[model samples]
Structure formats: structure tokens, C-alpha cells
Target: MEQLLTVKKGNSRTTKIDVEGVYYRDLNAQLRELSSKGIQNVQLLNVYGQRYIGTNLSQPMEIEISGTPGNDLGFLMNGSKITVYGNAQDGCGNTMDDGNIVIHGHAGDILGMSARGGKIFVRDDVGYRAGIHMKEYQDKKPIIVIGGTTQDFVGEYMGGGILIILGLNLSEEKTYRAKFVGTGMHGGVIYLRGKVEQYQLGKEVGIAELEEKDYRVLHDNVNEFASYFNLEPNKILEHQFIKLFPRWLRPYGRLYTY
Candidate 1:
């Protein structure tokens, strides 16, 4: 049994939910029910470590989460927009097909793992293997922007899409801390705004000069990210950026016996 309460706000039809002592399943059930009834905006309060907060939701709604959410926050989500005012746990956008996830604080490991389409913006640091195995097809391409530095294996096995690491909090001379970056990445590009030593990159990845199209992509995404966190986009874009891409389409193709 779960105890939850909902209150309707004036005019806007926004529903506020108090999820104290409510099970994750029950909470998600209520969310689905509300969305099915054409409720487009919801605010969840007292959400302490509830896993799968917005999993597999395809409706075009806005969900505001106030407390720290547990793992798999928006797994396989489509069309819904989720804004987390607090920190998020591991696998934030696992295989998400569409929508936006804006995190005000840090995020855990494997953020945006294998997301096919959508955007994820983190205002602070992220843990290991952020953006691992992400891919894109046709008009659907995922994008992830991290404001702070990350741990090891960032963008490991990424097949497509865009990844941006702003490194805003780091000193000008300090190199990025992540190692084995873009390991086994075959497609897509990664934009890093800080120093990275040669040893930090995987052998399969190579650095390239930014082109006009690349600049456009960075400008749009960085501007959006800066606007979300109330930072100046110009100051963030003033620094140099390095592009990382795979040297070969299949780095391990020779390893397999075909």
C-alpha cells in the first residue's frame, strides 16, 4: 500500500503530487494514469530515491522532480520532458528515445547509456562511463552536455550522436580526468572544452579540427545548456574545443573471425 496526495493548482491545471512513503510502482502508476487523462504538467515532491521515476513514458508532458531520484530515472522515455531539481542516480536516460532531461546537480554513472534520441544536460559532474554505447539513426540523434568533469571511460563504445564536456569548473591548465575516452567509438563526435593528454584517449579514437558544422552544433547545444543553468554562453564558448572521433568504423573488426 502507498500513501500519496495530489493537489490541483489554479488555472494552469498543473497537478502537484506528494510522494512521501509511496512505492515507486504505485507512484509511476499514478503518473501514467494522470498522463493518460491528458494531464500535461506534473510536479513530484518528496521524491527520495524512487527508481524508474519516468520510465517508458511517451506522452508530451512536463515532469518536475524536486528530490534526489534513484537509478534509471527516465529509462526508455519518449516525448516527455523531465527536470530534476536535485541529483540523479545511475543510468539517468538509459535507452531513452526522445525528450529532454535537465539535471540541476550531479549525475551518477552511465548517464544517457545507449540513448537513441533526445537531450540530457547536467549542470555538474558525472560519474564513470557517461554516454556509453549511445547511437543514432536517420533523424533521431541523442545529445549529452556535461558542465563539469567526469570520471573514466566517458563515451565508451558510442556509435553515434553528440557529446559535449564543458569542464567549466576546472582550471585552464588542468586536463580532463577521464581516461580511455571514446573507446570503441565508431560514429558521432565528442566535443571537449579542456585539456586532454594523449594517454587519456583510447587508441581507436582520434582528434580532429572543428569544422563549420561542428561549431554550429556546439553553439546551439552550449547555448541551450548555458541558458538552462543561467550561465553566459559566450564565456563558455570562448575557450577552445577538441573533437574526438573514431579512427575506424569498426576498431575491433579484425578481432572477430568472420
Candidate 2:
């Protein structure tokens, strides 16, 4: 285990770890150690299916991952940036507080469940419940943007945050297939660039016209999303978008109130 990871010698600010065949616990311990040492940048190579790759990372550092990571990639993270070169498994950013996660490929289920703050950008599709239960805490707000479509219940029970689905991979004539979107949602917003039928939405959701403030949010976030994947922000913003808002606060409160 000790020989598998090599620390880059003579570089005080930056270090590289060859995390090939190392256990997840050991890898994380090394990460915590390096972060405490004030390492500004860390690169992980050959990281195949390592779960909890960036858990409990509170420092403002950068991580470059070469291979696919396992579930809960950034669980409970704070104030860091992680860029994945390959696909990530389920629960990519589960319950993260503050940070940025950039995935170059697709991700599995529950992409950003219960995230309080941070931004997650996936260049490809994600599995079921992509942004479930994201909430705002005081001044913190979470944001998630997907370049492709997601599976069912994309934002189920959302409390607060911003979610954008560009559907850049889908044909213009096709509609997003995620059904029951925003089911049980009481807060937050979703912006979609492609088509979705009214019947596909949950009873609690309603499509609203995009206001000026909405456009500004789209322009800024889409610009950053575009910059990550080498896309044209103007071309993306040229397309018409639909805004989905929760019809009211606590959409299901009546069921429990009386």
C-alpha cells in the first residue's frame, strides 16, 4: 500500500499521488494529511472506483482525478474543487456544503442529493434523482448544471437551489424523458433548454415564463458551464428555455396538516 502511492518530491506547493490499487481509507488519510500540510494542488492518478474520494475536504485546494471515482465522490465537502476526467458512480456530490465538482463524463444516480452549497457541472447525462432534496441554508445556495438529460425525478423534493439541464445531447424534436420532475418540491428552480411535456411534471410543479433575473442567472452559469467543456455560451443561450417553479411552499403540507 505504501509503495503504490508516490508523493512528488521536491515540489512544496504541488504534489501527485499515484493511487493505483490503494484502498479508499488510506487514500483519504493521505489526502487529509496533504491538505493539512498546506498543499495547494494535488493530482490523483489511476483512481479506479475509489469511493468517497473527496469527503470532508475543507481546504481551498484543487484535485485532478484521472480515472473513474466511486459513489459519494464529495460527501460533506467544503471549499474545494475536484475535476474528474472520467465518469463517476452514484451519489457524486451527496450532502456537500461548499465546493465545485466538474465531471467530464456521465454520472450515476442521485448526483447532488441534499447539497447545501456549491456548484456541480456534469458534461454528460446523470442517472435518477439528479438533484434530489437540495436546500438553502442561510446565505448558501447550491447549483447543478447538466449538459445532457437525466433520468426520472430529477429534482424530487427540492427545497432550494438552481438546476439547469441543457439537453445538448438530445435532438431538438425529442423531449426530456424524466417523469415526475420536481415531485414534492417546495422551493428551488429548474431551467431547461429542451422540451418537456406538461404531463411529465409533478402536480406540485408549474412552468413559468423566464424573467430578467432568470436570464442573468442563465447567462452567467451557462457561460461557466460552456467554458468548462469548450462550448459557445451565446449559442446555448440563443435557444428558448422553460422555467419550472414549485407551485407553492410545502406542496404536500396539506396532506400532513389536517
Query: In candidate 2, residue 80 scores what lDDT?
Result: 85
Report lDDT (CA) for all predictions: 0.91, 0.90
**lDDT (C-alpha) at residue 163 in model 1:** 97
The C-alpha stretches of model 1 lying farther than 4 A from their native spots are 1-12
Regions of candidate 2 where Cα sits further than 4 Å from its true position:
1-12
Collision pairs in model 1: none
My TM-score estimates for the predictions, one after another, are 0.95, 0.94
Across 143-170, the per-residue lDDT of candidate 2 in tens digits comes to: 9999999999999999999999999988
lDDT of 1 by residue, 37-128 (tens): 88888888889999987875546778999999899999998878999999999999999999999999999999999999999999999999
